[model samples]
Structure formats: structure tokens, C-alpha cells
Target: MISASSQQKKQLQKYTMLEGERKQGQFPLLEMSHLLYGGKDQFDKFLERQNFFDTNPMFKVNHDFYNKSRQDQILLNAERTVEAMKKLSLGDPNYYTPNVLCPQGIFISTVHFAMVIPAFQVLASDDQITKWMTSLKNFSAIGCYAQTELGHGSDVQNLQTVAVFDKQTTEFVIHTPNIEATKFWPGELGLYCEFALVFAQLQVDGKGYGVHPFWIRIRDKETHKPLSGIEIGDIGPKMGYAVKDNGFMSFDHFRAPLDSLLNRYIKVSRDGKVERQGNPKVGYGSMMYMRNILCDQYTKFGGRALTIAVRYSLYRKQFKDDNKQEIRILDYQLQQQKLFPLLAEFYACVFGSIKIKELVNDNFNRISQSNDFSLLGLTHAVLSGAKANYTYFVSNCAEWCRLSCGGHGFAHYSGLPIIFFEMSPNITLEGENTILNLQLARYLLKQLQHIVSKPSAVPEFFKFLSLETVKVDDVTTIDNLIKLLGLNCAILTKYAAQKLMTHSDMKESWDTKSGIALAKAASTFIPYFNMLCFLDTINNKAKETKEILTILARIYGITMLLNNMQGLLLKNQLNSQQIKTLQDTRESLYPIIRTNALCLVEAQGLSDNSLQSLIAPKEGDVYMNMYNFASKENSLNKQQVHNGINYIQKMREVNAKL
Candidate 1:
């Protein structure tokens, strides 16, 4: 048998070989990075930030970092987050990337940066901005967006938290009437945030005016103590994101000045007369912004996980080939089957995210200027569908990457487990994926009704619904493939609508019975959008890059079809022969993609510091790097015997006495 020293030496050799393989690719890594980052300047800026983090010990991922107690982790995260903000001058407009504030993963300051601050910017009136925005920017009063209550997560209409307007004091009395009304799972509210953008049902003169956002102080800004009549504390350790102080809050009888109401789209006078302005849907802007952010965040999660998995697969050697030489596990057909398609999906998500973000920004600007709510419905539907789809895809991809790595993936140093845990909440947060998808289905059904009534009046996005049927022969071409997917989407939507219509005019009962069908219908639109964005990107690319992206796009399309083949088969959209053809096409593309897999992942331009995976070392010193890092950073390594040993000894003595 080979000794431990021999095994170590062999692993080093494999690492070196894998490093050599990565360098043998034909495409230029820098050029791909430029493409991925949007431009050379953006790539440079990303590199600069990455280099800074690389040298900062505070950002390092030590083994003990993952093993820390929840309280310690939260405290450390809060300190590091503040220090990062200061050192990086994070509030500067030039340095603002959604990620600059929460560099590694979810941080204590995420809800403040992504939700609270953005909500204030978009929904707060000019006067309110002037009074509170500066303090928020300066971190004088940290804030959380407290929207989800224990009983009402996605169903905002039923939120029990009440805000009654007191015409006498010109104040809003916010009260949590019961346990279910307590605000739950607002990041930073548990420990750090001084204030919150609380969503409560507004009661004016004993009449309900739906849920509205009101700014309320939850804790004292000076002492970081819970304010009088406010009860707040951390909700204990979660599956992941232990550092984030996701907390619960309840107000006994909190009073806020009338000006605390975000009155950009709605206003109320001191006399208690409520005046609604702009579109009522505009109140969803903050939630929409977070959903948009989630689309991009999913790309990041998938990219990082793929980077680690792909790199490790290239280094791990298992069975010997016919030549009696052990080949890298990456050469196995099964491994490629698991990872390559995901790599393509990751790219699709990247492009799709950029498209959705641009769409949202344009719509937001239009709303601010003209209050043209024409595109608001479409934007909401698209974002809701995309967010739900992408989060589910990325979360599943992360788990698959972990499983693909075999035993090492189980170790915390592998980085996959943390990613899996951290991102798991994404499916439930913002909006539950199932509920969000149903919302999209509802939108699609509306559009379908319009199409049926007047095909010419259908919006540009749904115009394809009136097109000619896709022939089986056309499935080989990308455009035809897209048409086929679109056809599937239309069919699914129609089927879901039919199912809903069967409920005998009871809308609530229809929604309840058609939930599964509606979710499935909405999910079909995601790949269609992804493919549309991906095709647009490839069409705009130069010839060389276009060729590579075409291959990736094909892989993505085929993989999506295979994954959803059962639905397509049931709908008669694809036949057995076509399914076989898709399988064959997927098989044919694997080897070609395997040649460029390393280069493709490298193009994402993720830094070693950002990845924080020992298995994905920059220099490809995979085994030794993991060994040394684990040895140095694991707190248990420093101890000769752990406390568990004494417990075992005591149990043995009791058994002997018995």
C-alpha cells in the first residue's frame, strides 16, 4: 500500500498537472473577463477591489471562521462589515456595486444596503429623504426592511400589524396586536439596526387603506438598545448566515410622526384625509428591487460554486484509463453531464440578470419622471418569475456541486456547504418561489386572455403566442429551439388557465387547486427568457466569442429540455425521436465543452479571495493548500483533547459502575 507521504506527493503531482491543463486553453482569459464584467474598465475595477480584499486578513476565510458560535460570528461580521465600509469608502458613488457592501456572502449590513436604503431612495418623499437619508448614509441609524410577519409572509394583504393614524397628535400608532403580528426575519433587526421600514396595515378613521411602509425606530441609536415599547432580539441560529442577526420585533404602542410615512406615491394630510397619487403598484418598488437583485445574486452563487466544483473535478483522479494512467475525474462522462450544463446555465443567468436589471432601471426612471405605469405590470411579472426560477436553479446547482466533490465537499473548507446554507434562504425570502411563480402564472393568464381577445393588441413579449407552430425539423436551430420553448410556455399557460377555469367561478378555489400547474407554467417562462437574453448576447458578440457562446447556448437549451422532457412529452410538444436527438446533441457537446471548461469558469473573473475555497486554490495546490489551511485555521487542531473526550470517559465509568 502507498504510504501517506506517497499519497501526498501524488496529490501534488495531480495538482500540477491540472494547473498545466488550465493554461493549455486557446481562448484568452482576460478578454473573456472583460466580456463578463461588461468592459475592460469594469474588469479593472473588479480586480482592484479583489486585490484589496486579497491582502486584507479581515476578509480571509479561516477554518475557525466557519465554526464560530452564532453570537461570535454575528459580532465579528458586524465589526468586519463596518470596517470594510470605512476602509473601502463604500458609500462613494464611484465604488457602489450592489456587492461592495456585502463582499463575501450575506452580511449583517445587507438588508440596510439592498433593501432599507434603496426603499428610502425610491419611496421616501423629498422632505423625508433630506431628513433621514443623510443619517442612513452615514450609518448614524442603521435600518431594516421589516415586511414579513410570522403569519403573513407572501400574503402582505393579511399582515396583522396595524398603524392607526391619530389625528390628535398627527402621528401613526404602530402596534403588534398579537404573536402572529410580530415582525419576523428582518436582517439586522435582531441585533444592530436602530430603525426599520415597517410594513403595517394603515387604518384611517377606522377604515383600512391596505399595507403601507412607515419608518419606526426600533432601538436607541446611541446605546443600540431596544427602544421603549419595542421588543426585538435575534431569532437564534439558522441553517446558514449565522452572522446575520435575522430577528423578530413587536411594538407595544409605537408612535411615529406622520412624516415618517413613505409618501412618494401616497400622501395623508394632518386632517387625516388620505390622497393617493401615482400607481398603487409603485408601492412594490422595494420588493421588486430586491427581487431584481436576487437574479444577479443567483448568478454569483452559481458562478462561485461552479468554480470550486470544476477546479476540484479537474484535479481529482480516480479510475485508470485503458493506458493504465489515472485520469482526472473531470474526464468522466458522468461528471461532465453534471457540471457542464450548469456552467452554461450560469452564463445564461449572468446575461439574463444584466437584461432584467437594465429593464428595471429604465422602468424605475420612467415611473419617477412620468409615472407611466404601462410597463410596470410586465416588469413585475418578469422579475417575479426570473427571481424564483434563478434562485431555485442556483440553489440546486450549489448542492449538486457539493455532491459532485464526494467526501471533500462535506468539509467546510470546500466552500460548497456554506454556499448551500447561505443561499437556501433565498428561495423563501423576498417571496417564496412557489408563490412568486404562481403570481407570474396569474400575469401570464391575463396576457393570454388579451391574446385570445385581440391577438394584435398583445404586448411585444407575448406576440410569439400568435405565431405558427414549430416544426420538429426546426428544433436543431437556436431560433427554432427558442420557438419550441415559447410554444411550450404558451401551451403550459393555456393548460393552467383551463385548469383554473374548471373551478366554477370561484377565483380563490381555482387558485388553490391550480397552484401546482400555475407554478409549472410560470417556470417554463424562465428558460425562455434566459435563452432569449443569451441569444441576444451571442448575436451582439464578435465572431470568435459568438462561436463559443453558441455552443454554450446549445448546451443550455438541450439541458433544459432534457430536465423538463416529461412535461414536454405529456404536452406532445416533443416526440421520442426528438428527445433522443436532444440527448445525442447534449452528448456530442460535452467533449467540446470539456476542452474549454476551465477557461469558461475563469472568464467569470472570480478572485481566489472571493471564492474562499481551499479546493479551488489559485495556483492549483489543491490538496496541500486544503491540508495546511485546515490545519492552521481549525480551532480543534490546537487542542490535544477536546471536551467531548471527557464526556466519553464519564459515560464509560458510569457503564462500568452499572
Candidate 2:
């Protein structure tokens, strides 16, 4: 190990070097933060929350926490999470921010905040909400959204859990009809929550009413013990989220009050009668909300992952040129190629998430106030595609960031491994990326058909499908690039529609077989939408900000095009010469982006305390931080002689005697 004094000297030198790099940026970093946070006041509020969490002991974790056994990690996380909630008074007005509970990035009680509360807010009747909302908001009763079963994940329609009404008792007897009906993969259900918003098929008078949400208490709130007829326990450790107690649950004729049915959309009467109101699709509102939130989460996750990699790349030096001075990895063309494009992607995700949030909120309000369900289908299609596409991008880019940092990334202290693992589940959860993309394609084909029937009545977003293709003088401009993507989506959607029409007699089987093509058509539209969002963000900016953002936007658009070159060629969206030009243009944008990379990452407004990566301190004192973290906090380094070494020595002695 290097001596402490030597480490300190190296750290100081790197810190000085990083400062010099920061000074070279063309724009003020704070201005970028303002843009990222939506406004200066919002950025200030974020900082206030971040500072509060940083100073609170309940949110702090030892560096060696990562070295603990999974059970120990879960216990620590649970204890700290509950303590933080109690002190912070979660569920109060604006009290729950994503970072406050999980400062180190592992989600604690996320199901309670993201899934359970939203389930109630969207699905529960006003009377039911009034009865239960107080207890929920006070954290007197914790809950999880239990929908996925052992046999069903994305296929919610096929879930086997059953809720049969008992007219005599005025209750619903919820049961796991078979082993496949056991609820699985609920975030807080295992050992934390006392209740769940369980999804099961409702039965009234021996007739099925399809799947619906029911609030069922599974555990004693005071005792934290499983209640009668409820069997619940944690699933084993996963690739990540060691801290989360993701659980499985089985019910044996579990009884819940008749009011337990969240009946804002549909209700069950005491005499076993059913009253259906509003649209059946209103049940999907909670899911759309969560998917929108996931988009925002992806932006933050991608930003932090890139921040760690980019900052470290600037501080870490390798291979010396002929001058005998080692070069920073960020200066290399290959490194720039890997890291800068992701920075652009991070920005795109940030802006795209903002747009999605606005769209979802506006549609939800219109649906609630005016009972206008006309926009629900469009909202679902857009949010589902955005969730899938953004999550996939964040997951892949996080892995790229990890790989770019070399071996240091594999270590827990680097922060990349945790981000990659935590974000990986997003691709599968909310909705599986491929399945969601296919659903988006179905929606698109329907929209295209509508446009064909009524060209002048197309939705604003889909109006491009009705436009005639015009020859472009400059293919590199954002407008032309977006047009090309729109053309590609239209072409792909048309082909998918034709295939569906040809197999109308065997629609189910045809859809199953053509799933891949349908998913690709959906995937093409996401980047197009993302580019539109990015363009909108820059269109209203000041001259300097616009120039920088335009560069980043072009980098994002061109990189996406090059990566999907085969699809573009197959659809004839770009000729060979245009593809070559895109490649060359992408290469030229790298250095311009790299020049502003540090400033862009700094603009994310992530504090060193929240990052908790030894190699990515804002001050750039990585060598010293690594030394202190390993020497002081790593359990393996605390002793001169290891227990394993002694065990091996005893075994060797016994072998000699034998």
C-alpha cells in the first residue's frame, strides 16, 4: 500500500490540475445547473434538501457498509430508513425526495413512496382515501404494490391471485388459487410493509370481474409480524439492491373488508353486486405515473454514473507520451468517444423526462376534471415507450461508464457497480422494455390508421406521419435529422400494419411472431421524440447556452443514428453517402463536447456527499480519499493477520502430520 504522505501529495497535485481544467470551460457551471433543475429557485431547494440529508446521521453509511453480508445490509438499511422517515416525517407536504432516504443510491421504502401511495391516490375512491389516507401519510401503516406473481410479471391480465366476495361477512376472501398465484418481487412487502395494494381477479356471485386493486393488510403494524392466512418473507439477495427486502407473499383465504377494494373506477356492493364507473383503463393511471417517475430517476442515475466516470477520468492519468508527462484519460479520442456521447444522452434524458412529466400531469388532470379519457391511450403509449427507452439507455450507459473507469469501477467504492445494478431492474420492472416497445407499436399502428382515415385530424405529435417527404439540402441539421427519424417510424409502422392486416384471421399468433419487428418500430420513435425534446430545450436558450446545447443535441442525434445505421439503411431513411457523412459529423463533435464535459457534469448539481464515491470527490482528491477509505473504513485492512490465514495454517499442520 502507498504511504499516507505520498497519497496526500498526489491528491493535492490532481486537485490543482482539476481546478485548472474547470477554469477552461466556456460557460458558467451554475447556469447549467439552473437549466437542469428547471429554475434557479428549484436548484436552491434541491441544494437545501441535499445539505439537510448530508448533515443527518440517519442518512449516513459507513464505507464498509458495502462489505457486510446481505442480511446485515438489509437490517442496516431498514433501521436507517425507518429512522429517517420518523425524523423527516415522510408523506408530509413535499417531505419525500428520492435522495433523502437513499443518499447512497440504494432505494429504501421506495415501494411505499413510488407505488403504494400512488396506487391509493389514483385507484381508491374518495371515501376510501379519506378513511386510509391519514394513516398512510402518517407512516402508521406502510404498504407495497403487490401485482407481479410467480407466473406473471408483465402479463398482468394472466395473474392468478383471486379475491372472492363473501356476502355474509361483507368481506373479500383473497386467496392464492395456486402456487403460481404467489406474489413475488414486491420491493417493501418482504419484511417492511404491513399492507399491500394487491392486484387480483375479483369474483362476485361466481362471476369473474377481471383483475383489480385491493388494499389488504398482511402484517400486524405494531408487531411487524405476518398476520393470519398470510405467508411473507424476503426473496434471496439479487445482483443489486442488497439493502431492499424484496419479498414473496402467499395468501390462504385472507379476508379483507369490502371497502378494501380500491373502487374509484369500479366498486363491489355488500350484496355481491358490481357497479362499474368511468373507464376500465383508469386502473392504468397508477402505472403511468410510476413510469413517468422512472424517467426522471433514469436522468439522475445516468447523470451520477457519468459524473463519477468523467470526474475520475480527468483526475486519473495513464501512459506517458515522449515528454515523460502522463496524459489524462479524458484527453484520449477513444475515451472521449465512450464518455461524451453519454453526457449528451444524460442531458437528453433530463429534458425528455421533464416533457414526459408535463404531458402525463396535464393528461391526468384533464381526465380527472373533465372525464375526458380521449388522451389516456396516447398518454399510456408515450409514457410506456419513454420509460422503456429511457431505462434501457440509462442501464446501458451506466455499464459503459463503469467500463470506462477500468478496474476501479468494479470496486464498490467507485459507485458505478451499485448504480448499474440498481438501475438494471428498471428495464424489467414498470414494464419489460421489449414488451412495452411492442405495445407502443400497436398504439402507433392504430394512430397511423386514424391518420389515413382523417389526415387533417391527426394529433399534433403524429402530424408528421401525414406530411410529404421533402428533399433535404443539409441532412445534418436537427430539423432534417428529426424528419428522417419521423420518416423511418412511418415506414416501419406502415409495414407492421400491413403484416397485421394480412394475418387478421390469426391476429394473436401473428403478433407473437412479429413481436421483434413491432418492438423495433416503437424503438425508432423514442429517439425521435427525445431529439424533439432536446431541440425544444435549446430553442429558447441564450446564444451561448444554445450553441453548447446544440452541440450536445447533435451528438445525441448523430450517435443514435449511427448506432441504428442498419435499421436506417433497411428502411432507406439514409443512403450510403449520408451515413458516411453522419459518421464523420459524429467524430467531429466529440472534442467540442469533451471540452465542455466537466462543466456539463458539474451542472448535474450532485454533491460529493450524495455520490459517496471515493474516486469522485468534487475537490478531486481521489488518491487521498481512496487511501483513507481503504485504510480506515475497509474491514479487511483493519487487522495484520486474517482469520482465514490462521485456518489455512492449521490445515497445513494437520496435513504434515498425516
> What lDDT score belongs to each candidate, Candidate 1 first?
0.81, 0.81
lDDT of 2 by residue, 312-345 (tens): 9998889998899999999899999999888888
Rate residue 229 of model 2 by lDDT.
95
TM-scores vs. true structure, each candidate: 0.94, 0.94
> Which residue window of length 10 is worst by lDDT in model 2?
92-101
Q: Residue 166 lDDT in model 1? A: 97
Please give the clash total of every predicted structure, in order: 0, 0
Q: After superposition, how far is residue 577 of candidate 1 from its true place, in Å?
A: 0.9
lDDT of 1 at 300: 73
> Given candidate 2, what's the lDDT at residue 587?
83
